[model samples]
Target: MTGLFTFGETMGLVVADGIGPLTYARGFSFGIGGAESNVAIGVARLGGESCWLGRVGPDATGALIRSRLEAAGVRTIAVPDPTFTGLMVRYRRSGEFAHVDYHRAGSAGSRLNPADLPPSELREAAVVHVTGITPALSETCRAAVFQAVETARDAGVPVSIDVNYRAKLWSRFDAAPVLRDLVGLADIVFASPDEAALFVDEDDLLGNLAKLGPAEVILKDGGKGCVAQIGGERHAVPALPVTVIDPVGAGDAFVAGYLADRMAGAAPEQRLTTAIAAGAFAVTVSGDCEGLPDRAELAALGGGDLRR
Candidate 1:
């Protein structure tokens, strides 16, 4: 049975080796990045069982993404599409700051449809991790995300949603209602402060979100930490202090850590502790999913690690 399940697009990442523009970079490396996939990989690294469902092109970049996720121990059920695999480029500029460029429009990932969601697999999952970005990708992709959530809800499996809203995908005014609908279906909801503000004011964000039906709501405040309301109880946790490296996948890493603890029946405080630890580690590395830590590694990180 799947302990944790996440679905969305995973794209090939091209990262510059040094601080400069993409054109002037002397060397580059490849990896994979996506909110859902990053969370899936983080869960796997923490020794939790997780599966990823989606679409990928029948091409080399797609092969790379599949091989990496499998290597990280995430179960994959990605369908093959004839279009090119989606890709993203990352460049570090002026120290810790990084910029990412997407080349994913009309790619195989955006072609996701309801047919890609397997009912049996959804039924087997202990929890489903859904994202707002998939719904904004394309009409068909939106249907697939909705189908996955409905399948999980009908199966009595918990659903977690991350409002990873991307402005490039859709306008906020257009996305608010859809996002609000998704939040209502979630057992647990995660959103950055700005994302939550898209629908509700800062003061009432958590309360207003809870009024939508989720049992839990998390508002990520970046380096300041996160505030959550779980089953009508309020909890707040501060972010772990770590030197910044790359911040791209930190949020996904946090979700994975939280899920890892939740799967183990941890208390709310413990869950957020592990989550903050995971996020701290994520920013210390350059790649999206590479910085995630396993159980032992997460434990060892409490005191810190020193490397030359």
Candidate 2:
């Protein structure tokens, strides 16, 4: 059985090879980066059968993303458009501080429509995963996400949502209401502490989010670790301390790990531990999803050893 199905926009990422502005950089490296795709890749890396549904340009960058995801064992269903694909430039100074520039407006992925999705593909997945990013792309894409979620929910397939808030994309007319409605439709919700702080009002962000709707809620707090609440019981999972390399896709990695564990019938506490370990491994490596660990690597991370 397939473990997960995710839909979102994947863009070509250009990163400066050395510490300087994009204009002054001597060279660059190219990769793919997108919240939903990152989580799908992470799940695939952990031996889970995951599929990614999205749109891309009929260009080399789009071809590269499709090929890379296929190589990583993720089943990709990509709709091709004539427009140029989205591009993001990442700049780092001293390999510490970082900044990103997005050139995604009018990109191919943003042109997605509800008609692009195949009903068969949406019906076959165990869990349908989506994020706040896709809805922010465009009105058509937003409608498509709602349709996908409704289909999945109606078919008795659990829907998982990652509240990946991007302030750059949020406007007065978008975001808040859409995200709240999506959260209500989701069976499982994942949120970073900072993102939760933005939407919910409570001293304990995790607790507040659980009250919002999702049957299960996972709260990620970077190095501070994570907490999982299910059936009114809360379990705190401590973070695994590791040398930091990059923190970009850690949250996505954590979601993949947590889902993988849940698929294996692991308890909530165990799932939380695996999730934190996955996120810790993610921050220790450079690339977005490349840092995600396999099943064996995750198993080797001793329990409670993060305190060391």
Q: Pick the candidate with the highest TM-score.
A: 1
The TM-score, computed over Cα atoms with residue i paired to residue i, of candidate 1 is 0.95
TM-score of 2: 0.94
Lowest-scoring 10 consecutive residues by lDDT in candidate 1?
A: 299-308
Model 1 clash pairs? none
Error of 2 at 206 (Å): 2.7
TM-score of every prediction relative to native: 0.95, 0.94
Q: What is candidate 2's lDDT per residue for 1-308, written digit by digit as tens?
A: 46798888999998888776667888888999999899899888777789997789989899999998998989999888899889998888666688999999999989988998877777878788999988998999999999999998888888899989888888634677888788889889998777776667759776777778788988888888878788689888778868888888999999988887776677788778878888888888887778888877776765312211
Q: Where is model 2 poorest over a 10-residue stretch in terms of lDDT?
A: 299-308
C-alpha lDDT of residue 266 in model 1: 77
Candidate 1's residue-wise lDDT over 87-187, tens digit each? 99889875757788999999999999998887888888888999999999999999888888899999899999999989988999999989989998889
